[model samples]
Target: MSNLQAVLKQYWGYDQFRPVQEEAIRSVLEGNDTLLLLPTGGGKSICFQVPVMTMEGVCIVVTPLIALMKDQVEQLKRRDISAAAIHSGMNRHEIDITLDNCIHGQTKFLYVSPERLRTEIMIERTKQMKVCLLAVDEAHCISAWGYDFRPSYLLISEFRLLIPKVPVMALTATATEQVQIDIIDKLEMKPVRVFRQSFARANLSYSTFLEENKERKLLQILKNVPGTAIVYVRTRKRTKELADWLTKQGLRAAGYNAGLPFKERSDRQTAWLKNQVRVVVATNAFGMGIDKPDVRAVVHFDLPDNLEAYYQEAGRAGRDEKKAFAVALFNKIDLEDLAENVEKKYPAMDVLRRVYQSLANYYKIHVGGGEFSAYDFDIQNFTGTFGLIVNETHYALKLLEEEGFIQLSENFNNPARLHFEVDNRQLYDFQIRNPEFDTFVKLLLRIYGGELFTEYVRISESELAQIYFVPELEILKKLSFLKERGIADYEPRRDKPQLTFLTPRYDAALLPLNVFEIERRRERDRQKARAVIQYASNKNRCRTILLLEYFNEMDGKDCGVCDVCLKNKKNEPRPEIDEELGNQILHYLKSFGAVTPRALSQIFENVAEKPFLQTLRYLIDEEIINYDQVGKLTLNSKYHS
Candidate 1:
């Protein structure tokens, strides 16, 4: 075996390469700036880790997902691979210890968020260290045109400059050709080896169901796939609600979203990971750091505005080289709701101005006041207090954050959790008497070896429970026992928090009313959403073909497996709509005002050919005219014309 492969097997227990993982690792080992475009669930970590093992200095991996960073760090420590994670969750002392370890000890991997690099001390730490490589996970976030872009990622070039010779590996699961270029430009990578795997998961069956009763449809999909499952929703409340409802249907289910208290969230996640919970219904926030291998299906309860977000979230279903189902549940109304969300994501200038005004008012600062003021603004409550729409207000707040008006705090309430509460001896001792809890406790001890004796370790027990099922109480009791005996200390979990932009602390007048930036951001995001909508609604080829083509690969053929192929199999003829007649019918309705589709269809009946009739039927089918609960046509979403 190669030295890196030996290290991978010795530490991670994997004997062979995972497709492109070994190649990515070799690229990093060869001191090249490698851009790895693996699909979601492809092993992106080993690309940097194996290289770090072969190199001389610490690997600085900047990842935006806090849960992801903590998860990977814990995994490394479990394998006795010296690693540590630093993020906003850490206090001064925690930061001091972690940096001290990196500086003074044999730490191989240092995981962090891009936002954390803005600090003077963090930058100084990198400058002081003998850095081997800078691996930017989710590298697409650097692009403004990319889904989930963070402006803070722009500071990475400065980080690269701090340690000039370090080769940077930019890794992401999803990126369009445009996003790929933007990522390269933003990260300032050297002309690099770009390893892009085909953006196709042959194991995953893609199906989109157009049903108004989406909730019922989701339950039906669940019934078909019986193993570990994840149901992705857009909101935290919905995550819990769906889980709770599914559980009531006798399906051992639970919801995971940002709304759960920290301890409860960890406990629920741990349960899902252990197969104690059959299904996990969660918001997009839940899966970044989770790595359970047996998930049989992933169901999307709401349509994501863009495919990048969809691919990453849906891609979570299967990682064990097994069959998995990726089902998208949608109704015509979901498209409308999705459009509204995209609209709301980009704040209007008026709303942005109101937010600045409100923050100033909240802090009792005048136009030229409140410079560097740090406040945790809750979007729902904040908007409701001022009679502004929640979506509009939140969009405005995000704009402020992007413009450097404020530093947004995402989750201060649900602090990071760790499983390591004691060292090998103590944890080994605890597991001895608790023979009943042996496997669970040992898994905890093995996986989360870092920070077992320090302050409370933040952990997601769910991933650990992936190998064994145990109650949170069972894990907590051991932690509490250790704390009581002074073997380990534990802090119970609290909440998942949402933080907002840092307002002008005292310099209110200096806050730039940048209408240009806000509008530009809105346009960029909307254009992304428009592309996904256009692609999905196209009729010329297989739905899978369109998706593969979008990723810039040319050899893709009709998969003979997607919705379009199925329609073809059933002899569902392409409904030809007469554009001229359709336009005339719509125009006539607009001229007369508030006519039903039945009336419009009748008005054009004499002129209607088979195609025209089909077009008229398609219009009614699409609700170009509004459909009542009784199926009568009326006006909604747009004018008939």
Candidate 2:
């Protein structure tokens, strides 16, 4: 076996690589800048990971989402691979140790956010490390034409200058042709090798329905399609409401959103993955790093903002190559709301300036200060104090993030961590000198082991309290005392959302806001929103074909299972209906005096529509059955029994 295959088997326990995975890996191994475009659940990580494992030095992975970065790092560690991550909420001491590890060749993978790439410490430390590969996850974010653009991603080119000879691999699941070109140009990839998997899933069926009673339809769909499922709604409140309603109807379900406590979200997700919960009703925040392959259905309870978002979310199902369904249930109001969101997402420049000013005031940061300062931000408090609309303020913050003024991290739990500041000899001497603190110090060492000396270790105060037979507050007090006396560095658990200013606070009046660029982005958002609206409203073309064409794959065949394809098939003319089928339809009409077309269709539902409809039309033309003004079918007087 080859070295790459051997490493894959040893680490991943797989006999072979998935389609296009080995090609992408080989391109990177050959010292070529590679662009990999695989759909969601395509094992994009393995392409970069397996190659780096075969090499000598650590691979630097640049990603935008901190939660995903942490998850990937943990997953790598579980595989016995040394990995570390650096992000906004981490303290300087922690970042120092992590970067030091990379410099000494202790870490095999270093996952850092794009915003962290431009820091002076990161740059200097990276220059010291023996870097082998630079992997850019979600690479489309670097493109201005991409659906989700981040200005910080533009710094990656400058970062590339640090390790100029190391080959770069850019990975993204969804990117249009224009966005693809923009990424290569923005990242300054040299003579790149592009590997694109076709954007079609033969085993997954796509369907959309215009329903007035979406709840009833959702219930019917869940009943029809069994197995683990995910129902996506727009709001957090709706997630809970729909999940509770489904539970009362006898389906095991739970609600999930980012606002919940981290443990609760983790517990809920675990239950779903274990199939203890049949469905998880959630917002878009639920499916980032989750990889459950047997999700038989992913029902969109509300319209997504764009086809790119919808494609990625819906593609989460059927990773095991089994049959699955992606359904969208919407009404007229849903489309209007989706279109109106473009305006809400790109508020006026004055509102953007006001939000920036309010954020500065809320954080008590003076103008021309607060650069690189991170704070625990509560949107409710900020909006309430300033009398600002929450939704508009949110969009303004996002626009600001896109423009590179600040960074907003999703609400995540940063657990309490402890690192010993003193050597073991000093710690033991101090414990003996201060005998009152001896027992607590011994307990910390006994429970956590010696890793706390080398790096920050996550500690639970409640667990420590239970072991020591004291109140939790006592444990907290001891930890604070240790930090105060310089025995150890302690950071309490924090669960609030974080907002970090990327640059100095600017005066609201002269913020240098780019009006023309904002307008161009606003237009781009409207175009994307309209594309989504058209996809939901279209009735003639096949759903799968529409999606394929949207992604610049115009040669796709019609998937025969979508609602549109089935409807068209039913309406086609068939001249081959035999006499026996006509007689059966006539006999049924004779017994039932008058029946609606829908009722008749239901009675003959098992029969193929083309032949049955052709036989019915034959009978109608022959006057054997009366097709009436009320749109009911009845036997003629001469043929009535």
Candidate 3:
């Protein structure tokens, strides 16, 4: 037996390991705290998957995204591996069974949300389980200092204390040096092995275009490129529109969004991955835990929130490592719109409180009544009725949830799954005894079991429907039936896009909040928006360089294959331009004090085509235009001289 071949063939059906997968697996099997820093689509799962089989106990993977946990467990179960997840979405029975199973080591991998580790039941059960390793996915979220902060992540350290000997492996696609340090400090893992794969993708090419006809550019790509593609947009509305546009342009494409019923999204994603649908136009909500290797391209219709998110999203392409393309198309107006969107999202305390109050009234909530209540939130529906921007209103709702005013149905946020070992005949007989379980049993019959028997599964009505030939509403109905029956427990799902309302009674002045933390979060969101803008607008550095620097890696050589480097030359300075374009740039400098490449392009919109680009290139070559490290331009010293 090749050392790595035992479980790889017995369980996973892989002949050999991808670059570092074997080493990572060996480290963990050797009982070490291993941090695997692989690029997105670098087979992060197998590192943990391989060792779980060799070990004699359960391997608990702490994941942040409910969908991600569900998808992973689903895939594992497909391969006959036993796994399950315990997260916020499930009812008490589901969690109890999963936890009990973990305790008995019936499950190999038991998935749980970071927040679940904080719960009394989870912690108590975790104490009993013979844990092989504590795998933390999206490990960067634990850092309140990082771009995305979840207070629930703070509970991870508590789990660390619960199982002192259990090794912890924290994994994320994009974490800067600061975020990485915070993950180690926050988790307090001593003597961990930090494994990093090179961030560079030699087979992929990067290109960013400021095009007026963004959709047309996308269409052109679809027409020219062959194989599966993922086009990312910023919102649900855009996901729909772009998908339709691509399909109309003769590309077999579909939309994926958080607002989509889980079933439809799953079917569409499946079709795309199976090569039935040639393209998938989706919001950023898609692409986590997706393992389509032959994707020909990843097209960004809007700027991403940060270099980290962008890298992970873009990395979704070319997973088979045959040549693939990553393209970001933007306009100046989108950048402006992005900034305004940021301002609206970080609403004032009064605005947040007011929105909370409105939600309570809408739901007819009263004091001490939030404990067992559930509500469905519609962004356009709720915001329009309340006279608020949907973006801003959603942000306020999230804050309310964090303050423990009320629990929200995280949009399809089933972090865990629950199932039992009842015989099919028993389940059917129970349906006769308990007619309510009928639909749920029918639904259960449609699914292949991994989540229930192996580990936990993610619970989402719509996602379940996609695997079967059923409607999304029917899927929800079955789960709802199970939830009500007390025989089966299912998570209260936000299968479609939604914001959960917290607090039984929302009062304007009485809600307890950390003023500094709220403001700090607001600042962090703004910083992310700026990063989104900067990534789309920057024209000076190699796309690869911009990403590497963001991750705190310096003194790195450029990837000569990217658009910026290949279109020009390696490390060659920018060009100088003639007077008219230089004058227009100077005028922009005088007007805005400083302007971005995208911002500057907007100022001379009257000029046809690439005139401004040609002019700017000349000015840059002449050293008449000077840009900062972040690509903010100013009047060059030599321009005045």
Candidate 4:
């Protein structure tokens, strides 16, 4: 076996590759630029991961989400592979050490944010390292036609120029044909090998339930389906409220959102993964890095902003190849609400510029200052003070961030950080002098490794409290005491989102808002909104067919199990029973023997279809007639000559 194949077996325990995985791996190994258009749960990572294991040097993976990067790096480590990630949440020293590891240590993969590619440290260090491959996760974000575009992603092409020999492999779970072409052109992929798996998912039964009381329908669905499920809502408040409602209904459930502390989110996610919780009611933040395979249902409590997001979310169901459902509960009010949301999401360029200037002013940053500075952001306070609508202000800030002027990270519960200030001898001497703090200090040294002496380590106060059988607050106070004594440096975690300036502050009047680009994106969003609305309101076509057609697949067959197909089947006319038709059916059966439903329909030329079917069914039910194993009509013995 080839080394790559052997490595894949060793790591993933798979004897063979999925549809396009082997081909993609081969393309990358051949030093050709490849774009993998795999669906969610299609194992896009394996296509790049397996090839990296076979080759030498580090693989640089540029991704957008910090949580996802960490999750992937952790998974790689669990498989005994060397990997590390650098994101905005990490302090400069932590990032510096991680980069140093990539350059000098035995690290095989380095996951970084797109913005980090432009940093001086990264630029200088990566030049010294041997980079084998460039893998861009969520490559669609580089295209305007994509649903989520980040201006920082465009910087990837310039970075590629610095290492012209390294082949680029872009992968995304969701992308249209236009987005695919745009990815190739934007990333400057040469002689690209495009691998697209069909977007159709036959295991997922897509349905829409139209009811004024969506909560009621949701409860009914949960009761009927009886497996793990996810209910997606738009706002963070609804996530908690709906989760409470589900709990009241006596199902183990939890709310997941960006606002929760990191520890709470981790606990809830672990509970859900372990089947301790039956459902997770959450916003869009909940599902990106989750890999649950037995989720029987994924319901949309509110209308999604676009079809791309909707498809990716709904596709989370039926990953185990078992029967599952993707349901959307909507009312007429939801349609109106969606329109308003679209307007709020795409504020005018002037509003975006105003929000930018206000942010700078809020941070007390001058026009020529604030380069690469991080500021704690309170959305409610900022909006209230400026008299700006909360939703509009949030959306405006997101647009500004996407334009590369600033980088915004929502509330991610980064753990508290600690590093020892004194070496072992001095700390031991201090511990001997202060016996009250000795046990705690000893625990810190024992639990965290010696790395705490050189760099900060993310420490868990709750874990410490559990170990010592004390309150978390007590542990925090002890840590504070140690820090005050100059034994260690500690930084507690923040519970709010942060905004970092990507460039020095620019004057508000000449902030360079791309008017044409912004307007074009707004139009695209409008089109996407209309498409999703149409998908929900549609009652004639199969839901699967509609979704497939939107992704440019016209050859998809009708999924005979969707709500529309089932309703149509229920409405189809059926033949009725009558004495005259009954006699005719019996006589024809006696003469010609058994016939199939289609043939019987054709034989009764004078009789209407439904009436003929009704007669045939009635005779069979009466025992005066019957059909043989092969469906041949037969008279009972009493009627036989």
Q: Give the per-residue lDDT of model 2 (tens digit) for 599-638.
A: 9989989989888888887777566886665769988888
Ranking of predictions according to lDDT: 2, 4, 3, 1
Give lDDT per model, in order: 0.73, 0.90, 0.74, 0.86
lDDT of 1 at 639: 66
TM-score of 3: 0.76
lDDT of 4 at 351: 88
Ranking by TM-score: 2, 4, 3, 1
Provide TM-scores for the models.
Answer: 0.74, 0.88, 0.76, 0.84
Candidate 4: tens digits of C-alpha lDDT, residues 1-641: 87777988999998888888999999999999999987788889999999999888999999988778978988998899989888766777677767777887568999998988999999999998899999999998999989889888999999998889999999998887898888999899998998878887867888997899999999999999989999999989999999999999999989999888777888999999999999999999988878899999999999898888999999899888677999999999998888777677777878887898888878999998987788778899998888888878888988887788988878454668897878989988998999998888878878997878765677989899999999999999999998898888788876668788988899988998888888888888888889889999999999988988888778988887788987886687744569877877778777877677678777788787677767776676456886665766678768767
- The lDDT of model 1 is 0.73
> Can you write out model 1's per-residue Cα lDDT over 1-641, one digit (the tens) per residue?
77877888887788998888888787877778889999888888888887788788788999976667777887898888888887544556567667766776468899987877777778887777878989999888888777777777888988788887889999998888888898888877776889978877766767787788987888888897789888888887788788788888889988887656667777988988888988888877778878888888888888778888877877887777666887888778777777777777765565667787776676566654443344445566766777877666666776777765655555444343543444668667866876765775556556665554443456654444445566656666755675576554455553434343333343444556556755676787787677666654555567666667667767876765566665675576656667887778677656766655567667777874677667766676465865555655555547633
Worst 10 residues of 2 by lDDT: 620-629
Better of 1 and 3 by lDDT: 3
Model 1 has how many clashing residue pairs?
29
Runs off by more than 4 Å, candidate 1: 356-389, 404-509, 538-540, 567-641
lDDT string for model 3 (241-272, tens) is: 88887777777889888777766877998898
